[model samples]
Target chain A: MSEPTSQPATQLPSRDAANWAKPVDGLKVGAISPEATNLNVEGKQLSGPLAGFGQMWQKTYRIRLSGADVTPEQVIKLWKENFPQFWPKGNRFFGGVGIEPGQVAVLNLAGPGGLNAPGGGPLISTGIMVIYADDESFSFMTPQGHMFAGMITFSAERAAETTCAQVQALVRASDPIYEIGFRLGLLKEEDRFWKYTLTALADFFGVHGAEPDLKIVLVDPKVQWAQAKNVWHNSAVRTGLYTLAAPVRWIRRLAK
Target chain B: MAPVKLDITTRKINAKTSILDIRGEVTGSAESILMAAYAEATAAGAQAIILNFGGLEYMNSSGIGLLVTMLIRIQREKQRLLAFGLSDHYRQIFDLTQLDKAIGIHPTEAAALAAAG
Candidate 1:
């Protein structure tokens, strides 16, 4: 727990410390690296889990750094700085050098078809907006057309004198097609992805051989049928087609 | 300056409506309290759940995630979920996250109760 800082008596209590992002009408991918493909996220509205068509799930992953003498702030700072490094291979993250409120991050995640599929399942280019950031915690909200319409929060806190880092996600498949993919082994892969990330994070903090705790709750089992049309914006399909058309675009550029 | 503390207590609005009076700052620390309060409200057979945020001073992104989880739980039960007493800034938070569309937001508890009908 953070203690109140001594301030001049005139200072007022305010939310200045939270570092929340200014409201935006929709998402804008600003200053992405040339290597990153920004396809589905630009101009899309931010979508909460409620905008999705699949069953809602709340998943929490935690790993305790038992002997590390780091504060919650230190843990979060390290996590934010090395965010992309913890991810598994093949996936790419681009954009901000540091995670801060309102920054957009472009992600080229492995598609649902897995690595065995044709063209190695291609890649799904999507993105998230950093909605809020504080010393001990920060969060990212997915934009419309992302695989999961949801928010994922990364927080570090002390639990019983042990420093614990956590990643909690409240998510649902953005469309019917994603829901089908999630039902067919994609969910387990997603869980493994986070678990591996957490393990890497723990290793970074010098906590070798640490096992992370995973908790998943099915908050809502029924799909929201009204959001069935979200499939029209499937990012995997768009990114795959974009990749497939690279040759044609190159030929046209040569002609010009 | 004391750290934010979240407290939740339930009040009966009618035979079918119950309001969860939420006080203090809501952050990552408030998760258990909020979940317990929601469980209590539902266990008492509330068809409509209204969260009164009148006394809330601050809420971080984690708090918003908690609300979304509660909303899903409420939806699973087919119960109505509504919220009231948001300061303009907090209302904007709801808007930016699109939670305003998921759960109805009202300016006052009375207005929320009226809408529960």
Candidate 2:
């Protein structure tokens, strides 16, 4: 045992500041798997919910691990380590190692009904930046060309005896084309994707057959016509063009 | 440390402006309270709403999301949203999330009021 001293506690900086990512001019991707196409991510500015064209929506998906005797910290540690493993098949998340603040992760997402682009590339090639991360939660903000302009936070919390894992998204379609996609079944696909992800997460904790609860609110119903120009940054079209030009690039390389 | 639940009280500054004095943490749980305060401000016929965050102790990404949600509602109602008293930490958060571009941030209550007019 040590004697208590009379020294005052040293002032510490805000804890939240350490957890948040520093501001970046634009997202830059680091190392990613060769199989993952790094399109629509580099040099793209982040677009939050206010920078979108369609109606704003808030979606919450949660699953309870009733019998799993795990703390929120434990759950979050595993979730962050194996984030990509829990996603639905055909969607590749090229996040190196683990999630951390300011890290940019590339995503190759399957289209509705697992459809691929004409050249067999993913239907969408986009990415997200980890904006905040801590012991019990982490958040990802999308780039401008992604389907939705917003952030999604994944967290775990203890309620009574059980621990609940949650993914809450506040988003709006990034452009008119994406808005039309959301209206035409993309929203349902997104819903299914999160439900599947949560179910998989539950299963990992030995909670088999757990059905995730979902709640969606149309936060704003009016579309922002001013954001219609955002279609120029559409990732889908850009990714398709890049894929189609693959052979030409190979031919040019051979000539050189 | 135990979290402090957010408390909001609306003060009418003038016929066209109302100030919402918010205390404690602004997290996901503060949604209903924050929205209710905004409703009260709008009901009082306030054309501009100012958020006073002088007493804010903590906030998270979810809190920023809630602000975006509230901003949409305010825009739909054709009301201006201004804020004062954000700490340097939260001001950086607003800048990082690009929210500062949408919601006007002022250094003091008087400055916010002047902008509201």
Candidate 3:
């Protein structure tokens, strides 16, 4: 095998600098204080869709704003500015430093294991890294131990001479346990999550009563058993343990 | 900014490997073309595939996600994937997004092919 070449940074061809994020040792969540119990995000490695253990899926949720008197750029800008407002209830998105590259957004989601809802669990605290952002689109990559190991992109474009807003997610369950959740109700719940989000987004532009068009594709059906060990970093379990140990940490802090 | 478009050319180098000569920007709009190219490579029954990124200019986060999907698909088929000619920026991107851990990154197609061999 040929040896890997080590080219100096200057020797590389020029690229659009603004399109990528600066290299980081680990994730650094910014100034936005998280409202949820955050435990699984700090210092975690960013995980792409390939890192997950479950079958891969591509899901798209789109809505047309034909007569809303808004351009694609306008829609994207507004969407970025008021992003958290569009999320479903029982979920909180803390947009730290406003969706720019290299930033992190903390998320608190209600579910069975984390939130401890009547039928559900406890609140799951996780985060996503803003890997790329532009005028028309932005995408977030999940961290290790997150529910879904993957990326989600939100973009706006002109379709059929009318403005369209879309959210495309390529993801897989981060671990085997979550894969079980995905096979049960997590997948449908996710579908509902994005559908409600898009509806609210369309409603923001005065396009009331617009239904989101949904598309789901199974990119790969084979489960990655080798990645089953990812369960060790499972955010739900980690967050729960962190919550249980909060008083211990508080006492330690007082002693310090 | 110019509208980003993707052009993919698949060439089988041997019975075991094929190279995907991808040119232009890989963004959200390039999804269909990338997926189709990957499908063609898989259908050709090549055991390993090398992605030539020498002509690639820009690839946003969504494009990275697509590559991740491709990685999963290739793995499901029990095939291997190698990539070459990514600029320093994208090399950093690969590491940042942990894609480098999933796919081999080489400085040249020749090196990638050698590694595949």
Pick out the ten consecutive residues of candidate 2 chain A with the lowest summed lDDT: A1-10
Q: Which CAPRI tier for candidate 1?
A: acceptable
- Candidate 3's C-alpha runs over 4 A off are A1-15, A34-36, A112-122, A244-256, B1-4, B35-45
DockQ of each: 0.33, 0.29, 0.45
Which stretches in model 2 have alpha-carbon errors above 4 Å?
Answer: A1-12, A118-120, B1-4
Task: Give every collision pair in model 2.
Answer: none
Q: Candidate 3, residues B1-117: lDDT per residue as tens digits?
A: 226588998888777888888888887668788888888888888889889877777787777777877787788789998998787777888887888888999887778889989
Angstrom error of the Cα, residue A29, model 3: value is 2.2
How do the residues A38-105 of candidate 2 rate in per-residue lDDT, one tens digit apiece? 89999999998889899999999999998999999999999999999998878889988888999999
Worst 10 residues of 3 chain B by lDDT: B1-10
Ranking by lDDT: 2, 1, 3
Q: For every model in order, what is the iRMS?
A: 9.9, 11.2, 5.0
lDDT of 1 by residue, B8-106 (tens): 888876778888888788876787888888888888888999888777777888888888877777887899999887766777788888889989888
Quick one: ranking by DockQ, best first? 3, 1, 2
TM per candidate, chain B: 0.93, 0.95, 0.93
A27 Cα displacement, candidate 3 (Å): 1.6
- Interface residue Cα RMSD of candidate 2 after superposition: 11.2
Candidate 1: the clashing residue pairs are none
